[model samples]
Target: MDAGLKLRGIVAGYGQGDILRGLDLDVPAGQITCLIGPNGSGKSTVLRVISGLLAPRAGQVRLAGRNVTGWSPWAMLDGGVAHVPQERSLFPAMSVWDNVLMGAYINADRDAVARRATDIAQRFPLVARRRRDLAGSLSGGEQKTVEIARSMMLDPPVLCFDEPSIGLEPRARRTIFGILAELRRDGRTVLLVEQNARSGLAVADNGAVLDAGIVRLAAPASQLLDSPDVGRLYLGAS
Candidate 1:
């Protein structure tokens, strides 16, 4: 598989110390690549670098074979990389339709934004059903669904998700995972940082285990899921 996003020898951190110490990762095109690791393993930091929330101290970030290191968040978005953070990004007081429209903020053409909004609403019925409802009025899963729909405003080729299912219930978690599978089917390259390793890998084509800011293990999702050592160390198996 061709690499949709690539990180080579990444070294980044906050203040004085480094979190990602020479990390290397490749997110393949048109597939879901799940990153699973213990807390403080630089999982979220990786997403930050990819989405330009944090610039790496060293190394390179490549998107579709183009060097994009140190680009701003807006530039990254324009370059077809959309990031959905773990925290809820909606304006609680705003209507769902309004929140979705906010995704097209960078687009100058009103007609194009309107057409994309319509297409996204159709793709995510929750957006249409709650078009007039305040974003805070929706359930956790519903809110997440809207967030994803909004991210599609640009029809990006690469999406980076940071623990998308973190606060949801079991059914909602399933729904989010289903949506992730759908994104893969739509030919989007996804880089997922998931705390729920089992569910994440269940929907992913590849899995990488992060430890001490670098990839400790990289393999097919099925192989990682079936590995007894992996189960004990990362998957929380007894």
Candidate 2:
């Protein structure tokens, strides 16, 4: 099967300075691909380029064999590529159920939206657990759970998550990884940028090491984790 998301020789940046140069990668379908790198290696930039938050100066981004480079964020979302950025993204005053439903805002069919919401709520019980509660009132971990549930409201084939486990306790981090594992079982392609290299690679099917704006290595997660050099340099010693 073709890789669900492909980036070839991509060059993207914020301004005059480029952060990602000649970056190439392929995220296989029905698997989780974790991206790990140092502080300035453009890990988050990769997600931004793929999700259309930033357009590349060159190269192409292909999703399911179709070139989608330079597409707008909204266009990318509509094209089955949903991005959950690094920051906290939720309406503080909205109810949990309402927040999840907000994800289907682009759809015009009320009945279809309601049906999808029902399915999502069933899949993520947290939505129902906090159905009537305000989003801001939930704990960080609970909020993250709601965010994941909201992202699924689109039912997209590919999901891009930027540090889904950031700013959480070990238990919460474990929950996020568990969610990623479940996503893979459901056949969704996941591109994840995680700072906790050890735990991230533990749940990932594949791992890519980014350095200085380029991919230095790409291999099976277990192989990368077992590599002494990789562990010493990036994985923080085995």
Candidate 3:
């Protein structure tokens, strides 16, 4: 696997409360890697650490093996890591097109931003159709789609999504996963932390079960999905 992001012996937490202990994981180039587990499993913390929202107490965070263990939040963005948090991140009063353009605020080039926005609109039709509607006017699923489209401003090589299907209905959940698959088809590394284990694993190239900040099991997503043990424990399947 071509390395897009790597975390080794990573320990992170909130205010002395350690959630992730010695967690090691990898996101290979052009693949979707899903992290699934029950609540309090430190799934979101891993995304936070990767995005530089929270610093890992120990261990290494590497981008293509560059050892970005302790880079600033802003630096990490410029380094090709884009994070889409579970919560809707758009400005409720703003237009969807504007919100998507904001993702490229770090880039000083308007032409480049415009070019990417065009690409994203073509990819995410909501952005094109709802170009003038207030972001808050969209449904939860539509808002989530816009959030993802916004996160692609830089065309980062790696994209990390936290609980992307959190508030979507069944049909919307299916659409969200479809979008994720499209991302993979475009050759982007996607590290998704999802509560919907079945949908997530179905689209993942690799899947890891995270518990108490540790990866309990890691394998090809399809294999893990087929494993009776995983299906019973994580999927609640008989």
Candidate 4:
């Protein structure tokens, strides 16, 4: 669960303008760290930087105390950084079992992938019940769970999730967050980017408030939840 992925003075954006301007933050090792912000606050950019999906114009990304600012996607995975993107990352045409197996393509051991699948099936009820079903046939929440289960196929130490609660009913969202809470309890480092501040922070040990591509505030989840400013600006609880 120890991750040393660091971002210092990172400047990144697509095409026209910069989304993250000199942003700096660290995903706590062996803890659940949630990133919250309004739309286009560079929340997703942070995940991309950690997963090596985007190269910073400046600054560094260190893992386990090693500089890996601009490593490729495969390099990041090899270094214990697994990123679950916001989009539907699973293969709709493939069976649930096959999708999970894809998580370990870099690993050469056939038995290892098989062993991981068994564990995944046990950890997630959806995978166990629908192992032979087409991944695309599942509901939104089920797909998210499968995505998470697939991520575990590698047993990554530091896993980053981008809006894992994107599209789902209230009930489904609760289930997904429940799974994440359990993961944190197991001493895994989880970096979650979620727009649902109230629920996201509820499961997080620490919460970082990102604004305009910068860290505006960082605090314990409980403390931040009670902050009047956070409630008004973030939770809209006024």
Candidate 5:
């Protein structure tokens, strides 16, 4: 399969020390790849590097066959990579519609933004249903739905999500996973960093186990789920 995104020899960290050590990864096009690991395993850091939140001290980041290493967040977005961070980025005082519209901030074409907004509203009914409501008024799941919808404003080819199902109810998590499946069906390459290893692998086409900032294991999601080594090492099974 062709890779939608590639990371080679990635070495990055914060402040003084490094967290990622010669990390390498490949996210295949038109599929979902989940990264799972113990806390401090550099899973989130990988997303940051891919989304341009952090620059790799070494290594390359390629998107759609183009080298995008060290690109700024805005540049990455413009280059077809959309990141939906773990934190809630919506404005509490803003209406849901306005919050969704913010996704097109980089776009100067008003007519295009309007057309995308309408398409997004249709795709994520919650955005249209709560169009007049304050973003803060919605539930956690609703907010996440809006976030994903907003991400589609640019119709990016690559989407990276960090802990998307974090702090959500079981039903909400399922909803989020369902959306992930839908995105895959839409032919978007998705890189997911999730703490819920089982659920993450369940929704993923491929799974990578990150340990000590490097890929320890990479395989089909089903294979990883059934692997005794994966169970003992990360899935907490005996």
Candidate 6:
């Protein structure tokens, strides 16, 4: 598969200290690419750069062969990039249906948004099941499904997820991973940053190990999964 998003010699940081130092990586299109690493490894920072939340101090950000370095979030969204942030981004007071429709807010055509919402609702029954309930009232797993369903409103080609399975029960995590697999089957490019290396690699077509802001290994998911070093470091192998 081709790269949907590419980072070349990326350098970014908050203060004088650079968290990502000359990092280089590619998220392949139409497949799930999981980024696994320890805390403070600049994993989330990479997502921020791709989503236009943080401007890289150096290097380039490319999407679908277009240069999008330093583009605003709106610009990125217009270029078919959808970012599902790590934090709870839904409006708690709004109904689940309303929250899902919020993803279509960028478009001016109200009717088109509604039409798309209908399609999304059909794809995710959870949206219809809890359409009348407040977004905050749902369980964690349900909220995740709603969030993912909202992302589909734009029909984006690329989807970026940050720690998607965080703070969820085993069943919820399984549900989330299954959703990711379904996305892959739909031919969407998925860039996933996951703390659970084992689970992440299990669902990904490609896996890259990041440490101290740079990629230490990039290979097929199976290869990485079979690596003894990787298993010992991240997979909790004895």
TM-score of each: 0.98, 0.98, 0.97, 0.96, 0.98, 0.98
Evaluate model 2: give its TM-score: 0.98
Model 2: per-residue lDDT, tens digit, 1-238?
4539889999989879999989999899889999999999999999999999999999999998999999999999998888888889999999998999999888889899999999998888889888999999998888999999999988998999999898999898888889889999999999999999989899999999999999999999999999999999887794
Worst 10 residues of 1 by lDDT: 1-10
Evaluate residue 29 in candidate 1 and report its C-alpha lDDT on the 0 to 100 scale.
98
Top lDDT hit:
1
The CA lDDT of each predicted structure is 0.94, 0.92, 0.92, 0.89, 0.94, 0.93
Clashing residue pairs in candidate 6 are: none
* Model 1 C-alpha lDDT per residue in residues 18-68, reported as the tens digit of each score: 999999998999999999999999999999999999999999999989899
Model 4, 1-238: lDDT tens per residue? 3564567899988877889999988777788888999998999988998888888887787787889888999999988888899999999999998998999999999998898889889889789899999999999999999999988888988889999888889999999999999887877889999889999999998989999999999989888899999999998789
Error of 4 at 234 (Å): 1.0
The clash count of every prediction, one per candidate, is 0, 0, 0, 0, 0, 0
- Which ranges of candidate 6 are over 4 A from the true structure? 1-3
Candidate 5 lDDT over 44-87, as tens digits, reads 99999999999999999988788999999999999888999999
- Model 1 residue 49 CA deviation (Å) reads 0.2
Clashing pairs in 2: none
Q: Which stretches of candidate 5 lie over 4 Å from their true place?
A: 1-3
